[model samples]
Target: MADTEFVIEPGRQDLVMIRMFDAPPDVVFRAITDPELIPRWWGPHVLTTRVDRMEVRPGGRWRYVNVDAHGREWAFSGVYHAVVPPERYVRTWEFEGAPEEVALETVTLTEVDGRTRYVAQSVHPSVEARDAIVRADGPRGGRESMDRLAVLLGTVADM
Candidate 1:
């Protein structure tokens, strides 16, 4: 299993995550941007994710909701700022529960020895906001999500 490395510096408003995938960059990129594949690996294994809306293009908007076994829901929405296929994408992410605390996120995919190196950086409005997310078990959720994605990529690459 690939481990997700998180970089959280003191007093910093940004969080960086790095992970390696066994699939090629294009395969990894498609798994992330394709709405059909998103639900398969978007969040924690216990939660079922639904992509309400997703338009993978510049200026497009996207939204997804994750429902737990107890019927609880967590909704997240974002707008794409830049969309470069098989390479990188920039977007703004906001969780509905925390209305105005938005984070500008950049996801980059690089080819490393025929595999993909995934790097994501999320910049929050303030250091406090970033810290709040960390306190909310964000890193654990992220790690789980990436782990799920890695599994999906293995199946996807086989196809």
Candidate 2:
């Protein structure tokens, strides 16, 4: 498997566009959907996460708690908008720390040859919300999460 890599771009939607990973689409999908596999790869590489509840179907809700270095525990909850096996999924997300800032996410996976290209889109309600997240270096945390995912996959994707 190749390591997960991503590029973040600022846009009208306050989008975080990324081209990541060189793993099988199923593997990447598993990283997103499997409760047992999630916390191991979920969150900024520096933060630790624990899945409180995860149900991966439309209307199913998922909850998680992330603890930062300062021992601050942040709680996040969301409902799954859609889930279709190992190909794609969409969900609505919000953190307790920022209730006004909701994030709608769409994740797509594709496999070429022996590798999978993973893309995730996060749409915020406002440009200000988007800018706030990016300026906070959101993807750095995501990068760490992906690195954890790579580790859980048993190996990093090809860097």
Per-model tally of clashing residue pairs = 0, 7
Q: How much does candidate 2 score in TM-score?
A: 0.86
Provide the TM-score for each candidate, comma-separated.
Answer: 0.97, 0.86
> Model-by-model lDDT, in order?
0.94, 0.77
Which lDDT tens digits does candidate 1 get at residues 1-159?
269999999999999999999989989999999999999999878899999999999999999999999999999999999999999999999999997899999999999899899999999999999999999999998999999999998877753
User: In model 2, which runs have C-alpha deviations exceeding 4 angstroms?
Assistant: 1-11, 155-159
Candidate 1 backbone collisions, by pair:
none
After superposition on all CA atoms, how large is the RMSD of candidate 2? 3.3
Clash pairs of candidate 2?
A: 1-157, 2-157, 2-158, 3-157, 3-158, 44-141, 45-144
- Best by TM-score, which number? 1
